[model samples]
Target: MALKQYMKTLSCPPGCNLLLDTSRFDNANSKLVDVLVNLKRIGQVSVPNTDENYAKIRQIIGNTINDPSVNKDLIIAAIMKTDAIRKRRGNSARNRSGLGDVFGGMDTGMDYGMDYEQYSKEKVTNKDFQANFTVDIEKEEKIFGDKSFGETLKDAEKLGAANNDITSIFPTAKTEEKSFEESCPKTDIHCAYVAYMENYANSLLNFKDFTQFDGKWMIARDKIAAALLHLKSSYKGKEVMQPNLDNFKNVCRKFVFLCGTKANRERSELVKSAIFIASEARADKDDLEIHLTDLFGEVKASPTISKDAAVQNRMLGADYADSVRITGSWRSLGIPSRVNGAESAIDYIREDNDVHSMHAAWHQINNQREPRDRKRERFFYFHNHMLLRIATERASNGLPAVQPMSNDVLHMEFSTEYNIRPENDPEGILDDYNSPPKTCRLTRNTQETLRNELRDLVRYKGLGMERFGHHCEQNYHADLHNLLMKDCDVGMLGYFAVSARPPIFYRIHSEINRVWHDFYSNQRYRRQDIYPPYGLTIRGITLHSRCGRVNQAETFWEKLGTHYKLNHQNFIFRIRLYNWRRLREKVIVRIFMGPQNARLENYFEMDRFVHQLDGNRLSEIRRYDKDSSFVFVKDQNDCGWPYHLMLPKGGDKRPIKYRLLVFVNDVHDQRVNVGTHPSLNNPMCGSNRQNMQNAGLELVDDRRDYGFPTNRRWTFNPVPIVNNRDRYFGYMSSIVNIVHTGEETDFCNQAYFR
Candidate 1:
């Protein structure tokens, strides 16, 4: 329930018993309250007694965030319920007044009353009041060097500096095998900025230019509300709840514009001449040029329509006035891009404007670029490959830019990584992630060894040999000979130098803290090395592995049938495992495909081995999961799941206490990459706190059913990329009960998705 307990619920490394004890309470409800407290602490929760219902609410929320598409009402309802609880709790809730005295008595319209001038004064002085403004070029250059932060940040791969490829280690077949594999960083985080902006704009827009706060806050309030509502609504209904900060910003940006109120009749009449002055008679010969000075900047009205007028308005005839006013200023304020929390607001400009022409002009010609921003404007933004590169470079080099612990996330190459660590076992010179595998001699000797590893995995693990046997010749390893000898596209990692990755699958649990989730249908990428092992999955995480090029609407199950000879029995095991994961938290189940109850005692020692690794040297260095799964995660602080490369066979303890950190020759300056906030000149640097903790706390209920975890609780570890699709179970009744507010989709479109 609490942010700390979130990982615990999932059976992740709760890390640091001391921190766990400090955060966890002994009572059942106390753990539930933990999550809410964390959301509130991070400024996401907005309920009365947030501290009380935190964990329970999060348990509900965690489910919804896991698959937001079908759970829209769940989160909103929880918010309302939390509010109700606050009302019931009276004094206890008041102490946690996140809404503050300023939002006093929001139930009735009377709450609208506020001193706009006074509020503005307050905003100016508030410690959190950082203006969304930019500085002169000289200052910007000094801080980020000559490279404009905007330019450098346009590409996601460049933003993270990931290795170009080589990371297809985890399994998720359906996601890989896509044609378009551009690694674009999510722009949805703009929702936070949108929230901030709407608050700022509301403080200004709703102003009656008077001391009375009553009427003015309505406009500001509505705009912000509309944006928030628009953004929240989408994620609430997703099958796989995704939280993209970029999309959040874009949506909010558009919604804010759309939320703008139209010009009153009085203003329209006054500016009648710039538009068509049709009282009873005709349409104008000239283009209907309405003055638009109010929206852009402060200016004096002129008696005539000066051709070169810097300040302008929408062109309108009488009938056109309403459309122009609504579609231009009012509608522009809430452009879809803005509403969806995206950058490049121009992308969502209304279709009413000749969209093609405007886009062509905006992108192709310098003339159409914003008049004032010509000196520093660019047309394009980051793509996926670039994002992958940046992220890989950062991850391999142990840089803060990209996180690697999340499953199947490192599936592709986005950049030409210039410098970084290799991902190999540190023990041997010939480790999987480091020291390139000896060039596979095309000689008969090399081919035999290659065939052997494939044979081993397939014969013992029931993978590769059978699957690829049909696709190739007797010496299947020969394929690599060509890939390695000619293309140079693939690289060596050890016994198997796989160059592809499954499509990127961000750990769903990783997004537990945020209020919104984003879901998409067509997120696929190239092959990764981990595709082979994911077949042996059951439960918590979604498993994604490679599939050949697919068509639209092709489900994972359909692809699985075509790729393998699996039947209902095997499928049942996979499905049951997935369900178990969603319901139970922090559980990692391995469905051994080979003989069940077979003697695997040698391999079975990992449970105790991991316990021995409790005080690991790597753990001592203080790194947690790299990509804080959700809610302003400070990577490696809470969600890291680092494992040793290549398990030791016939194991007792290892030959040595080896701890390896690989640096890729390709990755660029890996340590300092992070996303840039384009809206603000001075972006936030580093993170607030990682809260690195490993509570190792477990919930107690029926003992036999839980495999005797005892002190070590049975937490669920999501098998990412395993579940074919979200299917019918994503939004179970229990999840709905906690998260849904009973509000229909859009609180209006009950007829549809809700």
Candidate 2:
């Protein structure tokens, strides 16, 4: 008998009427109905959705029907007499029970174990069916019975105990201790010092109410010193201890100055004591000479200060303010997320104050304890990348490129009566460069003071390349930031709030880079500076994408409004070597991109790295955009450039043409061992400072000046430079056209190669 006729003849519950609806299942597949009818005839047995029952039912369905259109849910529902047969009404909840309950709420289109599409395309064997549907007790036993699992459990317990021990060290006041525990991560080695600072900041909030004024600051200084000593004792023999301790001391002194009164001739004793404390806390001879620079403004200065350069610049001009304001609500920024291989955008800001507070916390937790050099390098890299990202975002929105702040802008004079201020300064106390409020004239004098310092630094031209790089980087960059920001509030240009959130930060760093270029432009490499023995030569270059080999690609906006999605592509560089002397050699590969007609100075750095190459007569080196050394792995603490911002938005109608340059140079530094595990392939955003230091490595161990060749002005035209037949420096340049597609693309869906 036909299945419909047979189903009509059976006198069952009204819910069973849904089984007669052919729309729900294939008409040709009557075996599923026959099996359910047999189960009903035998007596309705409730089958719970246990793993064993699910496996058994799935196996029976697979054996009976080869048709993909057969609905497995109907079979399970009929056998178990589930409530799933009841009509769904207006997104209402189902009152399903047992095996039907599990299948009722789920997406019926999806296969529980095997892929639905693959199952439809190929025949399934009994072995394959069991492998897909049944759970293996032996595999579970192997994993749970392994020795490593036991060790992992023991380590987890130890970590828990360590967390408990750390929490116990906080102040005994319940509310304060709870706040500290919530604010700080227990696993962080520097959690103790962070807790101490939290308490110190809280204590300073009530400083005015204290009756005793005598030697109060001195007592606070001693407490900080004692904390440092304790930290040293607790983490003795640890490589990261000293670096973290030094960072703690630096931040502590800054906190004191910000939270304390300004120094003056009348309070000479306080000023002298502060200086003494700063000197005593110095970790090395080259540590910041805090005394030489006036942290606080002149005596009788107001506590309140102007906004940071970012906010101040916006206030100075309506055009700049509108430029940023139009991008989106100033209160919120969209961050992208990837889950189950699908991409979605989420807004992280819940309040207006969240902007500064969230960034402050991120910087504090991620960067406050890094080694001094790594911290400084990260600062530069972060600012530079942020400037590029901002420029790219603006371009995508049909705005002009971000203009670099000219030297004259920094030299511009202001009246003493200028009265612009920020709405709030939540992170002011954490600023290491806190200064007493100053008049506009005093601010101009600070600029002149910085100029004189730079002049003096440049006058002594006898400095070697290494020393020159250090002085130019350490002394000049730090002093420029401090002097430029001295008159502003703690949150203005301080560590806590100097992120790319402000548009003016990009301008300020643009000026800094200009100065850097001026210093390093003339320091070009001689022929002997680069090794020539390897005899490397560039053959040709090819670009590949998911759609196949292509010379042009597209970058589109993500559904999440804030970011642009980069095309997934790889660069294949074919090279040939004539004289292979060693088994292998380490080489540095530098990649850069710029507008086709733009000057060399206008180019943006894509990536630079130290890589190892096997000794062969010919080879092809392939690199992916996602694996660029410039990016950090997507994680909570990542501060590296977003991989999405790798390419700027191209023209809407005609594609924008860009020149891609790749430079290969030999590594001379013997301390660098590139072949070690966790190799230097992605070393730009370092893994961990402690781990790297323990291995006797810096964040970037390459002794060469960062952004070499391009750092200096070797030529006006890059074509000739790449076309040169220099054996020591082999370079290749290619043209890439970027098209702007005004649509959203899922970042995870892009084609990626291993």
> How do the predictions measure up, each by TM-score?
0.15, 0.47
Model 1 scores a C-alpha lDDT of 0.21
Model 1 worst lDDT run, 10 consecutive residues:
731-740
Candidate 1 regions exceeding 4 Å error are 1-449, 457-488, 491-632, 635-748
Alpha-carbon lDDT, every model: 0.21, 0.39
Indicate the residue-level lDDT of 418 in model 1: 12
lDDT by residue for model 2 over 213-309, one digit each (tens)? 1234335434444444322221221111232223334333333322332332212223223333333333331233332112322211111212342
* lDDT accuracy of residue 194 in candidate 2: 42
Residue-level error in angstroms, candidate 1, position 324: 15
